[model samples]
Target: MMKRIALLWNVVKGDARVLWHALRQPERPVWLVPATALVALYALDPFNIAMPLAGVVDDGIIVPLLLHVMVRCLPAHMRRA
Candidate 1:
């Protein structure tokens, strides 16, 4: 059990390093534009700030989509086993 935990931790650490590098690259992610727009919309909106839809979307769709997009956007070398 300890060995499995160690292995899982190592994998998570390595994957996080790769993701950090990919996201920190000079090139902006494709989703950044849309994400920024969404943020701006939220920021600019004054009435009815209770955004249940946004919370639901982010929790369900956006989170997974963002993760998928991030992995896809990684450099081939970084993603290589």
Candidate 2:
């Protein structure tokens, strides 16, 4: 169980690093910016802000999906194995 948590943490950290790099690259794919913005908006949506329990549930499911989509939008050169 601890190993699984550690592994998941590492994966999340790696994804975050890759996304940060994509944001910094001048030649980043055009889709990246909008995708990121959409994720941010959804994460902070009024509905989420208004209902704490539902917000937690909604974010638990949706945030990772949005992050995956953003990562998938990365250019081939930026993608890690």
Candidate 3:
């Protein structure tokens, strides 16, 4: 697991340019789709959905938004550097 995390980090650093370019595409939607899906799932669950709600908010919403902002705010050459 540690190795996987390290590998992911390296890949992200090396491919920052590509990743930023992909993210900058105007057609790409932000976290809205997943947020909507999570809301729907919560609504559909007859039992209490508090656990899933928390999970989605933390993992899905917060993490992605943070990553998106971080990527977008990075300097252009730094992305490739």
Indicate which candidate wins on TM-score: 2
- Ordered by TM-score, highest first, the candidates read 2, 1, 3
Write down the TM-score of every candidate: 0.42, 0.77, 0.32
> Model 3 — which ten-residue stretch has the worst lDDT?
59-68
Best by lDDT: 2
TM-score of 3: 0.32
- Candidate 2 on 1-81: residue-level lDDT in tens? 789758756766677778888888888888888888888898889997779899977886678667766777776788763
Per-candidate clashes, comma-separated: 0, 0, 0
lDDT of 2 at 29: 85
Q: Give the CA lDDT, 0 to 100, for residue 51 in model 2.
A: 94
Candidate 3: stretches off by over 4 Å: 1-53
lDDT of 3 by residue, 1-81 (tens): 789768756655554445546455564457534544554465455443557766644554444454445555555654453
State candidate 1's TM-score.
Answer: 0.42
**Please, what are the lDDT tens digits per residue for candidate 1 over residues 42-80?**
444543246766765444444444444555666686565
Model 1's alpha-carbon lDDT is: 0.55
Candidate 3, residue 32: lDDT: 36
lDDT score of residue 71 within candidate 3 = 52
